[model samples]
Target: MPHTIRVLVAKPGLDGHDRGAKIIARALRDAGMEVIYTGLQQTPSMIVEAAIQEDVDVIGLSILSGAHLTLLPHVTRLLAQERAEDILVIAGGIIPPADAQLLKEQHGIAEVFTPGSPMSEIVRYIEEHVRSAKDLELPATA
Candidate 1:
């Protein structure tokens, strides 16, 4: 059977705007991935714990409140501490190109989807990247 890609879509910090996250969650579910949305006002710890508990293959954080610097790194650190570094981490919202680079280089983020990005693009990215990682981790059968 094909493995199901589980994603934890979380809104960290004081970001009350969750429409984008909810939409993405719905799109991911429609695309055959399991999405667990943790709702608004979540802390980095909360996000990480939920990801671990859900055994998610990916995490998508929505941060429209400009707290990405603190929240994103905190989440990555927590995941690393919990030995869940294999989980792909992504973020969305008002992130600039520079911030995206910092997220990829410093926080170990796999992708950062900014405003005006299509849901299909995000879904495709998750599917492709997660499948590639899983393939690499599994040994070939004889």
Candidate 2:
């Protein structure tokens, strides 16, 4: 059987709000990808650990707490340290455009979606990029 696309939706760094994360999780699930939603207030280490343990294809981070620069990069760095950098990393929230670009350019984040981003676009991006990432896989990690 074909491997199912697995995604981990995470809230990092004291982000008490979770409606967006939950919605994305549901949407990924509805898209036929297995989604693991790590509830609110997760540390970067916790998020990376869960992604590793769950063996997800993608890590979707939702942060409304304005700590994306720190928390998001931390997760990617941890994943690299763990030899799991193949996992596609994406972010969403109230992130400013410049920070989003920095996250993708400097950090290892694959994409950053803002508040008004349509769910379909997010889903499509994951579907396309995860497949492409897998195609070039070094074999471990997401």
Candidate 3:
């Protein structure tokens, strides 16, 4: 059997809202990807650690706290520090267009989904970009 695409959906910083995160997680699951939803108020370290531990193919951050500029890059940088930069980093929630562009261009975020983005679009983006476990050439012992 083929390996499923694993995703870690995280809510970083003081973003107490989680309904969008949960929705995205459910949509990913429905699309046959395994999703690990990190609930609200998670730190950048916690999110990156979980992604590494879970061997997730993608990191989906939901940031409505206006801290995307700070938190998003923090997680991306941590992943690089951990040598896990191959993992795709995507974000959602109230991100403005200019900041989204910066996140993608400077911080290396794969994509940023604004509110009202179609679920199918997000799912398709992951399917197109996220590599499966088999594609990573991980050791057999992994």
Candidate 4:
């Protein structure tokens, strides 16, 4: 059997809001992907550790505390340090376009979903971009 795509949805910093994160996690689950949500006030290290533990294919960060510029890069850096940079990173919630660009260009975030983005779009993006572990393996030889 093929491996399922696993995702880690995190809320970093002091962001008390998690309705959007919960919604995205539910949507991903509905789309047949396994989602691990790292509830409120998670640190960068905590997020990366959870991703490693969960063996996630993607890390979806939701930051409404206007700390995307700081927290996003921190998570990316921690992932790099853990050599888990291969995991795709995506962000959402209250991020401005300029910061989104920085996230993509500087921090290597795969995508950013601002408010008003359709849940279908987020689901589709993950389906299209994240490669499952089974997909990366070579077939057995005869």
Candidate 5:
């Protein structure tokens, strides 16, 4: 059996919309990946906590309220602080080119997708980018 990639789909900050996040969650699930969706208005801390607790390999953040700069970076920073920076972080929705580049270059975001980006592309990216959970060396449990 193939290993399923575990992904946490989140909408951080005051983004009151969730259609895109839902679509992505469905896409990831359809691709045979385990997906957890954190509904609207989640804080960065909430997102990171869920990611760690769930032991997901990736975090997909969908932001539409124009707070990508603050929210995305804050998420990465929190993950770093929690020693969870190994989790791959990606973002989607309404991010500008410059800001997206900055988020990728400086904020530890793995990728950013905008409107009109195909769901297949999103699926393919996650499929290609996320390492299978089995590939990771887990600490020995007592």
Candidate 6:
């Protein structure tokens, strides 16, 4: 059986702008992926905890409040520490290309969708990355 792609859409820190997050959630659901929408004003810890509980394969963060530099890294660090490095982390909202590059280089962010990115594009990215992640597997330690 094909694994259902589970994703957590989170709004980190004081960012209350969730319209984009909700829309993306709907789109992902339409694409047959299970999505957990964490609503607005989430802390990095809360997002990580929810992702862990949900056992999601991807975490999509929407931070338009210019806190991406701080919040994105924090989430990445937590995921890495938890041995959940396989989870694909992507972000959207108000991110510059330079910062996006920094995110990918420093934090292993799979992709960053900027404003006006089509829904289909985002959906395709999730599908592709999820497949890629599934292809590379390592056995757990004793």
| Candidate 3 or 1, higher TM-score | 1
- Identify the superior model by TM-score, candidate 1 or candidate 2: 1
Q: What is the descending TM-score order?
A: 1, 6, 2, 3, 4, 5
lDDT of 1 by residue, 1-142 (tens): 6688899999999989999899999988888778999999998899999999999999999999988988999999999999999999999999889989999998898899999999878987888898898873322222
What's every prediction's RMSD, in angstroms?
Answer: 4.1, 4.3, 4.6, 4.6, 5.3, 5.7
| Residue ranges of candidate 1 with Cα displaced over 4 Å | 136-142
Give Cα-based local distance difference scores for all models.
Answer: 0.89, 0.88, 0.90, 0.88, 0.88, 0.89
Q: Report the lDDT tens digits of candidate 6 across residue range 85-137.
A: 88899999999999999999988888999999999899888888888879733
Cα lDDT of model 4 by residue, 25-80, tens digit: 99988888889998999999999999999899999999999989999999999999
Instruction: Quote each prediction's TM-score.
Output: 0.93, 0.93, 0.92, 0.91, 0.91, 0.93
- Which residue pairs clash within candidate 4? none
How many residue pairs clash per model? 0, 0, 0, 0, 0, 0
Write down the RMSD of candidate 3 (Cα, Å). 4.6
Q: Which stretches of candidate 2 lie over 4 Å from their true place?
A: 136-142
7, model 5: CA deviation in Å?
0.6
**Alpha carbon lDDT of residue 4, candidate 4?**
70
Cα lDDT tens digits for candidate 3, 94-125: 99999999999999798999999999999988
Residue pairs with backbone atoms closer than 3 Å in model 3 (clashes): none
What's model 6's overall lDDT? 0.89
- Assess candidate 5 and give its lDDT: 0.88
Clashing pairs in 1: none
Off by over 4 Å in 5: 132-142
